[model samples]
Target: MDTKPIAYTMSEKENPAITVHVVKKSVTPNVPSGNDSSNVTPTTPVAPTPSTPTGETIKQPAKPTIPNYAAKKGAAVYATRALYLYKNENFKNSQRLVKYPKAKRVNRPMFVVTDYARSTNGVLHYKVRDVNHGSKTAGKVGYITADSKFVVPVYYQSMPKNKKIIIINKKGVNAYKDANLTKRVKNYKKGTRLTVKKIVKHNLASRYQLSNGDYMTANKKLIVQGDYQIINY
Candidate 1:
């Protein structure tokens, strides 16, 4: 377990600044020849117009954050100063880049984001345009579906990827179901955890597939599935 407490040091000090004053005075020079010397006794210095200070206050901006999910080498990735990655057509071996990169690449590569994983401080990332690395922008996209209606359609570890998958949450609620949807089959336990892997929406009453294709009813009362974490033994 990477359970290390991130420590920080705090220090306080008075801010430093520069102070300046503009001295202004109205003095009548010796008008008469050698007669104003004794008469021109210096009066108390008058303070210039007392007013509020106004000008630009220069402040440094905070640095940009780098995400944790780095683009796979040769695999198209977003090349950001805050989120930069390597570029290569033939993606073969792996390598690592250090912070404040000494060598900089003038070329930029488009990136596709990986799902479910988090980067560094956990900033949500997205596909960097072209999903391919070899494409024009060196961005490449995955396979496309045949029937694209302008724009159409849109797991859990430990368990088999197949098994007619039904995703459940910490609450034992199945958000998805993948069971054979036919006529409603009954004579099962009441208030059991379930997944709706398969639902024949065409019919008024659909079948709700359970974790392993076992099921109940879509019209019946069932607990709603929500966010959950699986505790392994």
Candidate 2:
């Protein structure tokens, strides 16, 4: 029983075996060059076109036209109401030459129209030479209103069909034997009727030739075309 102990040795073919694992890797494809139609790229967005402006342009008003019935050149006119003489047709206050007060019908201030003009406001004006005898403003030239209410033609401008005229001036008018009115013949009282032969023009003023060969002023303020019942003034 003492001889049972014995030595033992292991061989290489009797050892346990070990196992190992291996991993696989992936590869990517290269891009084509030089204007390839198959290749795509990012694009930028486009903006919309703008519309044209539609604002309207403002315009100024047209000037007024002159009337056919307006007073003519080389005619006589007289003021019926107070008025101002202007240096220019603009009729501005700064352009005023003088202020004339309203006068009596028989002694109203008179003027001889030299030209016609229109103010900026479209009002018509008469360019005239003052002919008020003995007035300090006589012979002065200026512009005045052409309104019928403020100014009017001194003469009727046409012969009456009856060929008769009557004195209407309160102070009456003088009859002159000469056209220049230098020689005084007589002074006819108001409401006196006289037959007219014809009309005569002297120094841009009109005179009526009487059948008696005497001359009287044809001023509308002093004479009327038709005869009426005489009334004592």
Candidate 3:
């Protein structure tokens, strides 16, 4: 019996050198004429053949796509107060702007400026990267009129040290996952004094970026801000 490997090749119209191995079955050795049939050893079964390939073969996985809003590390910035974000430098019209988060009524939008340019009219336009916000437009980058009245360029003067804050709000206030008051992290009882590291303002509310880097809200009217010094500019 023959004992050679069977080769599978494409038709003449297809690849000529490309060959694949299918079955490699070995022929049973011829039994001696005097040997009994019961003494013959059983042959191993052949593996099933592979299915014919149809679609274009893929060798590697597709690369993960980078999102348009992917955060790029740059000069750190902070918003002096809440402000509006526009699609272009011409914000006076309001028609040329992207929709801001209206349902949450977040008037004071805050973010870090990523890029800046001057319009023909000598207006300064800044590409601000929105920090976490309560609206669907959160984490977006857009141009805004940086007239100093709104956006203020700030730097890290020093690492914030621990400071004590008292919750004067008789009702209570909420802790948040982000500086924006969109997500509630926890709730604090009235008179609940907390030792927070830093104080900041984002979207109309004063937020505490804690020593552990967690954030919580301090409503302007509810929590007293005069006592706690704003350290991080």
Q: Pull out the clashing pairs in model 2.
A: none
Question: Model 2, range 1-233, lDDT digits (tens) per residue?
Answer: 23343444444676755333333344557787757767867579788888656796566886655576666788888888999999989888999998999877777889998988887877888899999889999999999988888988887667778898989787788999987776998999888889998988776678888999998888887888876775432
Worst 10 residues of 2 by lDDT: 17-26
Instruction: Return the candidate ranking by lDDT, descending.
Output: 2, 3, 1
What TM-score goes with each of the models? 0.17, 0.57, 0.34
Kindly list the per-residue Cα lDDT of model 3 for residues 107-223, writing each as its tens digit.
Answer: 334456676655667666677777655766678777765555544433222223436555555566777777776677677766666767777756333467755667765433334
Q: 141-185 in candidate 1: lDDT tens per residue?
A: 321111112111111112222323222222333323333333444
Q: Which regions of candidate 2 are displaced past 4 Å?
A: 1-67, 160-163, 168-172, 176-185, 200-204, 229-233
**lDDT against true structure, model 1:** 0.33
User: Cα RMSDs of all predictions?
Assistant: 30.5, 21.6, 23.0
TM-score, candidate 3, is 0.34
Best by TM-score: 2
Count of residue pairs whose backbone atoms collide, per candidate: 12, 0, 1
